[model samples]
Target: MAQFDVEAFVDRQKIGRPQLAVLLVCLLVCFIDGFDIFMVGKIAPAIAEGFGEPVEAMTLLFLCQQIGLAVGAFVVAPLADRFGRRSMLIFACATFGAVTLASVYAQTLFQLSIMRGIAGVFMSAGLPMALAMISEATPRHRRSTFIAIALAGYSTGSAASGAVAAWLIDIYGWQSGFWIGGIVPILCIPLLLFFVPESLKYRTERNPKDPGIARTIQRMDRSVVLAGDEVFVLGEADGTARKAKLLDVFLEGRTWMTSILWAACFLSMANIALLAAWLPSFFQEMAGIPIQRFAIIALIAYGGGVVGTLTIGYLMDRIRATTLIPFYYIGISVALFAMGQVSFEAPIFIGILLFWSFAQTGGQGGLNTLITQVYPPRMRSTALGWSGGAGRIGGVISPIFGGVAIAQNFSLQLTLTCIAVVPLIVAVLVFMLGRNSYARQAVIASVVTQRGTA
Candidate 1:
């Protein structure tokens, strides 16, 4: 009987100073993501007054930004796979920052909307690229953990953005939010240039799969078979190399499963983006809370998400990733439904918020990890980003719908309850997908065994 060595498990990823620096750079980039996305919500009221426009008009702006994100994700992410991860990320960050800063000088509603939309397009590229880079940089076994940790920065950024916006909106006005958003990424440029190395796994040669994929497959063989029943999983690169392409996900072995997982990505991320975009405004408007207080409540939501994310990681390490995801979705749907019904009663509201946060935010993290694991390295980031990008469409739509419901004098309770249905449907979809994923993995394992015996 042998014991598990966690350190050795993690160390195989070769996550030294340079990789860690990449993580830090990713954190800064996500920080900008959190700040800018939420900044729109935080300053929505101010923007309305500044332009003397209705909240509904502002909601359209939110939708436009998300639309830009979806386009970027679907169109831009695949290019990262085609080119390289580091260049895409650096360019994405710098583009978003410079564009966002330019947004500060806009004088009209149209200008602000266009600038914000452009910023959204660029910022959208950052998350997927970062996820791809981190996955490649870390060892295979420890990839999810590193990914979860890296993603935590997004939540941290979300939390900090609220606090920062709460303070800055008073002193510098809504434009200041974009100013900070732009400036943060500008500062990240030096680090990205100096510290962030190109992903060791990304290819420079014409035959990208030649040595890299072969070497990874060799490592895999050593760890899984040669190492005996030790479950010696390679976190970074195994000795074996399997050539990976976007189409390979479907054509080779697990196409059905990949599609299912992509659907899960859509559901899980849609819920998170929807909430991140709308929850604050909903609380302030329907609950009749002040901006500062609403920010505090937003913190609570993010806090619950943090708990959920950590909890998902714990469950994933012990149990199958696919098996655990559906349960989280069920919990999220229930919590969101309860949120629709709950009043200002502190205990009840808090419970709703926590559940909603955990189920959606945490659930998203879990889904992301599962996606990263199921796909081969080549298409992993693109899949996650594209799926997430598609989910952003839902994010954009949810807030706009919420705003419409409120404007129409639709009962807040009814609107919120309706929103809960999206998660419920998503939970069912993901559960079905999870079952498919498990089935697919079993099939793959059986096929491998058959091949080995032959």
Candidate 2:
């Protein structure tokens, strides 16, 4: 054999036990990340009451955590290139876990807000690193499907937070939730350090001489033979380039995609953050339901997300994201507007909300997987991190926006309709992107076919 092209090898091979183990670890990490972020929203009412404060007073916690996410993703995610995704994830999880545990003792809203922000600093790292690891480990054709499945853990964890809180909050109060959230991650630290694999790209780039490279190649498939004295990759992953620069995301004909993707992330994350932060309150206030039951509504929404993510992931592999993403946003806009008009009957509102979740939440997974195809491995984590950071800016604003809408006493219908407009605008932007992104699958295919055949 002349040489081994690692990217080409992974793209053309079947995923095995090692890859499956990686996917599960990534899924578990992201699931915990989701659980941590959603936990605050679920327990908001309980914390507010415990602190003797109005719900509006708790908006600062949401705002700060989002700001932390932005700062971490924008400023810290690029460190993965230099430091390794495995190291970054381990550190982030440990720090976030420790801070979360400390939050259990927070005596005031100010203290809790600070702790939440600190937790966010590290929480933002989880998705970027996890996705980077998964993308590098899995084969190209199955990338989206596996990513969707790994991400499904996130939605599941978010839903579990509500159910768990519903069962535990009354008996042990808000602190109980924090205790659970914190301890599990701390426990996960050792597992991550011991078991979670490093990115194959990262290892090869860091040192082409790394023996792990051959092992990683073997792990991707058992059938390949490298009979040559030396093994090396063909192009961007050949260990010659410096991957730490953030500006790389804006180059290589990627300026347009990056810009539009950032916009979509911002709008979608804002709207989703708003719904996550305020919907429970809305259900309790408008539908006159018990507070704990509102979590069931959120759970239903997230359950639809599982179906939605997998469907979108499957379709994007066939249909171009340009067509899929814009239409998906349009569907979310329609579903959300319909949700506003539904009668307060629990089943009906939840069903429509599920439709909205299917479109918007599932569409988000599609965008994430689509993003992986556009950037080479060098740029993947940073691009994902920046897009996540950009979206989190909206997250930072959404809770305050929701608080203002509530404090000003806007009707639920008006609020839902107003928020629906954001996604419609996103649809138009993506439509322009679709026009520019023609033959994207062809580009992705070429990235693979350009490599030599055995």
Candidate 3:
């Protein structure tokens, strides 16, 4: 009887068309996730005026979005552990698709807020599930880069949202942006069903010895599919599902690592949520750029994120994440500080803000990769879910925090200075993490194992 070790096969083999196929489905949904998540913010200024509400009304929408995200992460994401990532992802995608469409006709701001809150719940689950599946599929050497590439879809989605807003919001009204965001995901549902396979590791883990799966793997990679009834699995225990213990994430030697990761996720995500939610308004109000032009500038900023992730993903493969992550955060501080002191000359101002976006969003994406590295397969989903929940908490607070600052009429320097402190804190925490022997050891174990399932 011939046997194939799935874990060894994936870790040893370079990525191929089979793997790329999975990533494509993940990326497409994440693109939809980004649009659904960020679209409300994109239309905020217009919606505020349309409803005869103060601009700060956007704050409620942002809060509801995060609140939903927190519930999704803390409450919903871990369900993937028992239910499987593919199922959770498809369900979330469908749920958000329907909710986003329903949200367009929400005549009252309160109704829109409620709808967005629910969308956030589903939106929150999309990325972590995609990351887990991608991580499981990728080879160890290419894990960071591949994960970053897939995640780049998200930033691209945000950039696309800016483009849509610029084009549609100006003419058909903000509702059109909502309409576009909603329709695309529903359209993708068919594609997801037909094209995207369940996580390979997951299927093998569930029923490693199944003859059908062996044939599927045979089709996926003929060389790895050994003949006969002998089929084998790697990086996972036998077929019985591993139920997550919530406390297990913090227990074991992972206590400090969990805390630090949560802290880092919180601060970095707060920075991202704050900036992404408010930047267009910032440029429109402060720099007096027209809404359409400012939206394009915002697009440039997020587009820089695509570049940042691709670049950083390459560097992370060579450089230590400990050293590299801290530097990225430091760069974030420097860029924010620079933005404050610089004159609003379009060229210089736009350049600084773009770099700022590049640094901030890239650094945040790194945090996502870092989570995959920090946790092993068994607890990975749980760790990501909770830390993501923490990030959502930060997301929940950021807009309100920024709103209060703006309400008090804080200078851009003062407002930004306050926001800049988060990454600076994250930098210190990252460096301290770098110094920790336990963290270094766990990270090494996860990378070397590369089973990437839980």
Q: How high is the lDDT of residue 136 in model 3?
A: 75
lDDT tens digits, residues 126-169, model 2? 88888888888777667777888878888877877877677989
Off by over 4 Å in 2: 48-57, 107-109, 219-223, 227-231, 234-239, 280-298, 346-350, 399-414, 437-454
* lDDT score, candidate 2, position 15: 68
Q: 1-454, model 3: which lDDT tens digit per residue? A: 4556676677776678867877887788778777767766667889888888998887788778878889999877777766777787778778888998898889888888899899888888888888887887777778788878877888878777767666888888878877877787677677667766666666666566767667666777766636567655655444444445767777767788888889999888888878766755665565565767765565567667788887777666656677788888998998887776676654787788778877877788788888877665555667788888998888767777766776777777777778788899999998888777777875556544443421
* Cα misplacement distance, residue 161 of candidate 3 (Å): 1.4
Clashes of 2: 0
Per-residue lDDT for 135-201 in model 1, tens only?
6666554555667776777877777767755688788887887878899988988887887666545
Return the TM-score for each candidate structure: 0.79, 0.87, 0.87
Model 2 clash pairs are: none
Q: Candidate 1: misplaced stretches above 4 Å?
A: 1-15, 48-60, 204-249, 273-296, 340-343, 346-348, 400-417, 437-454
- Rank ordering of all candidates by lDDT, starting from the highest: 2, 3, 1
Runs off by more than 4 Å, candidate 3: 1-4, 45-60, 203-213, 225-241, 277-297, 346-348, 400-411, 445-454
Count of backbone clashes, every candidate in sequence: 19, 0, 0
225, model 3: CA deviation in Å? 4.5
Candidate 3 versus the native: TM-score?
0.87
Span of ten consecutive residues with least summed lDDT in model 2: 445-454
Distance from true location, Cα of 98 in model 2, Å: 2.1
